[model samples]
Target: MPAQPSPAQSAQTQLERGNGPEPSTLDAHRCQEVACGNVLRDLYEGLVTEDAQGRLVPGMAQRWTVSADGRTWRFVLRPGLRWSNGEALDAGQIVASFRRAFAPATAAPFGELFDALDQAQAVQAGRVAPERLGVSAPDPRTVEFRLNRSASLPALLTLPIAFPVYLPAVRRHGAQHTRPGQLVSNGAYTLAAWTPQANLQLRRNPRFHDAAAVAIERVRFHVTEDAAAELQRFAAGDLHITEVVPPQPLVSLRRRFGAQLRLSPYLGAFWLGLNTTRAPFRDAPCAAGATRCDDRALALRRALAMAVDRDKLTRYVTGLGETPAYGTVPPGIAGYTPAQAAWSDLPQAQREAHARALYRYAGYSARNPLTLELRYNTSTPHRRLALAVAAMWRQTLGVQVRLRNEEWKVFVQNRKQRAITQAFRGGWIGDLADARNFLAAFGNDGPLNWTGYDDAGYRERLARADAAATDAARNAWLRAAEQRLLNDHAAIPLYFYTSKHLVSERVRGFQPNALDRHASRWLSLSP
Candidate 1:
């Protein structure tokens, strides 16, 4: 008889993260992509998690208790939890991870998530030590968080950055701990191999907390930025799930693979981010100068923002269903009322005329026009959208706008630099369901606020909202704050995204949610 394959050698589930070929970071503390979140969720457990229906469910802490004032929270860890290396994963690790997330040295991009925790802001600002932050381990199995104020926190705990960091692995390997072979994880899968710019292999972790319930034995992430290429892989039977359905063949594929094609609205927005600290975008461009950023710079931004036709972009360029974005916060997030963005209600001709006038007022004309570059990450849909917007700018404002593209990981790193490229594409698939979740990243010194948008009035409004006594009051203040940001033209709202994925027929238990988060741990493949 022919030699039989070992039991370990079996069929695997394959998936893709973003729309293109980009190798995102693996460290939960540093990772930011939604796809990265998907994998990290499988690899690490948070205090709480969202079910496929978007409801919060118990995770590392099987159950929790909150103080009446909401400033103190106590999480009781599930017993016998162990890391992939078989070390006890306890409250101490959870406490350490929370501290590391806000520690200035760790440089976690989502550090702003700790804005509510006591003394974390000071620690994040380098004014205090990370050890001074409020989280502590009251016992071997209990982690407590003391907050600055009483507000919603459960949703915040579900963020990827909140995942416990296994300190022993980090200390041993330093920055390279998350590398394939040296990793120690506590999730459904462990890193098997990572080939830069090609693919990443993940083997099911036999030591996972819920290992018995994890159906998929193996998983592979085919790193790619090309939407068309992803479609090709799906057709070739290489990818079991593709991140984006190519715009060109979306309709045909829906008909050809009816059961495999999934389309649903996601809680996200695609917009244009202007780096307000740079030349042309900033009037003074001096950090310590007495002269404030000129209003004319904002005028230029408003001119460009008004020129975008979101309705056309959603209908023509985005073949998959998407809604025109009037504001940063999408329509259905609980406790938030959408604020009217600039030019949302203006007539087409009037808006065009106003944009041209603003451009002229900002010292630009056809003879001596202001030129700028537009940057975006790789993806066919992104390319088409950039081109469409470029054409609109040329037609409406007569300004010279060039289009540029970069891979996802490199692009994210670029966006974080203080001296970012003049203008770039930015979007957010929310880490939590709240208006602040969308707005917090734009704070004066927020890690994601590369734009250098600092306004005392806006800051006050945010503070008021965060401290609001009730959800209703909180939302009112948030709405006002959002309106102020739009008036300043902090970012150009384009369109809200709709997720379209290619799920193979063999897979099951993939339920769509507004967050568009689907962890591979919950999935099973037919024999």
Candidate 2:
């Protein structure tokens, strides 16, 4: 283990991340939540990773080439690689990790990513053996992969799922593989300490291939959700970095912090999703003898969506540089154009009136109002949004809404298991700068499709878009597909995201990107 820095020295190197990442579980393969992703990125190096500018950069796989058919991808591993435990990190270990991801026993949360590999479907379904999956290693330093389709795989591998797993540790310790003593990381940093729902501290990994390039000696990420409280901590100098910035003090913080107060566009959408499998929210008529179950539920969805004043949500509530979102995918992603819902064209009054009419026609009134629960993770902004939107639904359409919130970790678990019974908050940060990354999640059996929206026609549009020969043609198909989705109101698009954070002046190499990703390894402190 590396020697610990003194209290005075640690103060200069330590970074305080106010309540964003929750270290619920450290096993990256089993954990899909961003909290775990943040920890894993610090602990492990993937075959590929996005640079500070959000471009593809080499990680474990130093360089790669594609076959003439574009279906076979080969990569060369960096020689003399060693894990934090001093174990060799070679192509064989990489192949084994990928096989584990595809095997039926491991319920890999991002296992959907493997579906792109050849024979992955059969391997995942238990039809074909796991060893038959399309990963091979001819030598310790060479890794080869055969893809089922033609796509730029390096970009996909940038996701956390593609990060190499230290198999020696995992094979020895099953569930507790990532515990402090058991874990072996090859990244710039390794887990030094984790006090759940409190703080996670990371120390520089001495065995990292390029540890000399790393600047920050230690990073302490603190769990903080309240924007106001985090701002206070930032002001007190107790926190060197925090993403939670209060909207009320934006103008003042700009004056005080100046360049340190960072506000940039985020390539993400904050929306609300209605569970399509549950009773009133179901996509088809329930067997409970209600004839208007399906049609009326859809009408109710559109009515609720139409009643929202997106402009107001973006203006007063968000108060950052966010925009009203009528579509799922945000603009600026490659091959994407904004798509608007039918109600977007109507005047505010007319939109509300139409919503009211739909509400009444769907057999919902203040006397017998359609009651539903809206769930969100613990955050002040979410509470404010839910309250404001609930007020709108009541005033515009006489719909009754109840707001519920839980810690982010528990909420994510429930959401993934389809335990959320009604509408829940959902925000998607693009894994890569592609429209397909956002729109592909809604197709039939799409991994990110939490709404349970399954329409053959909509799925066909996505398929056509995926199969299109040209970017323009694919974008057209995607636009039509988005229009259909918004028209059906599968999920209500509330607003786009704006990354707001505070970085101390002492911190260097903090380039602001749309993805808002700043790896601790890239950061250094000025003496």
Candidate 3:
């Protein structure tokens, strides 16, 4: 638990944060967006949580132990635990939450996080009942997990998918259980009020186990998707922290705010996901009497990937100290080295020439341009990036590019369905500091596998990685799997992400970490 706040810290307890679009739902099980996860972090506590430095710490579980084989873990809950509604919270409830998250009816988007658990895959596929999951509550305060193989389970527990839910409220309200008045949270804060497109308010949870250490009594998350508008709000003193800093006015912002401007390496990747199940990208027969019998779809995808100049995109468009990425997983992950594209080392002129040749081989030329749509969510940065990429495609490969922007909810839905999507903007932020968190998403049956990427060899390598007995063995298999994905051109890795925010000088305890998670409970405002 954090130390108790001083008298001065308690005086100005109200905090206003400029945030992105309104979360589609507060239900942790169904959430897939980073913005939604931010709110969920405050409303629920899993078996483990992260501190200001993003280090894993005890949450609901005060202490835990792992077996010699490393396939079984037991956690002992904190004493006198109670929900925000004043109901007793025990190990049984935690077990129930795990079952609910894996249940087929729930359709949890991030359910892949639990794939290491014994029988978790079978339970999610409806081959077995949810009760057959590896989690069991042996006693009122003791919960145990049985895994089929060894994994970083403690770090995985810090994710929202492992957080417990109030079963009684869920039963009574169904999907509406997360509403302000009905939500029964177990974290440092509770939902007080929510106005769509405006703000979502939370108050300190009096029944929280560490309430004495919570500094902020009230927190208001103001929905402002546009970075320019968020910056205005922050400058007007209506916001203590801006969700993102617009790339256009970054120079001015740095000059004005100086030390208040926060920029840190974020463990995420921004990329273009080609719908491998749809036209223009799906595996198709090569042209008749072609010199090479390679898959034309693969050639087209690779051509598009090679045409983009990622260095220019990062230095000019984003301009926020982001690293140009040639692979799915970002750098700096412990025990792993990321894989790069085969053509990553080619000179720009030579790369463009090679892309043109591949484009022609794919049966598209200046006379017959390959027309396609690029879809992205509405955001200033997204629009600029999309436009730049479209221009690059048109210039390098004689492709007709169409840009389509949709709201957050609609864009996510269309991208997930993949019936009409051609090439869409996609990204993933690591739930833990493991390369598996990024590589596993491309698995054939992965919930986050939006690209329809399915390869028998790739899946086999991932399976071997998961069952490996040592870190070296696991990372070797993981690296081989990533290399296969990059060679196949499943997705175009644009650049690694860097979190850019403008935090007021008055906000204390706002530490920058690789995960970019800053909960209001650990923050206080100076008057």
* TM-score for each of the candidates: 0.94, 0.94, 0.96
> What tens digits encode model 3's per-residue C-alpha lDDT throughout 359-407?
9989999999999999998888899999999999999998999999998
Select the stronger candidate by lDDT from 1 and 2.
1
Q: Tell me the whole-model lDDT of each prediction, alpha carbons only.
A: 0.81, 0.80, 0.90
- Regarding lDDT, does 1 or 3 come out ahead? 3
Backbone clash pairs in model 2 (N, Cα, C under 3 Å; residues 3+ apart or in different chains), count: 2
Roughly what TM-score does model 1 have, to 2 decimal places? Answer: 0.94
Query: Over 4 Å off in model 2, which ranges?
Result: 1-4, 19-21, 286-294
Q: For model 1, how big is the CA root-mean-square deviation?
A: 2.8
Give one digit per residue, the lDDT tens place, for model 1 in 294-327: 5788889888888888888887888688888878
- TM for candidate 3 is 0.96
The best candidate in terms of lDDT: 3
List, residue by residue over 1-527, the lDDT tens digit for candidate 2.
Answer: 99966888876777666647475577777766666776677777888876777667888888999998678998998888998878778899889988887777876756665556889878877899989999899999888999876667888787776777787788899877887788777888898887777788888899998899987888888887776778888889888888667766467667888999888888888899988778677766467766654488787788888899998888887787789998898988765786888778788889888888888877888789888898888887888889999998888887788888988777777766566658889868877676777766677463467787877778889778767777898889988888888888889999988888888888888777877777887778875
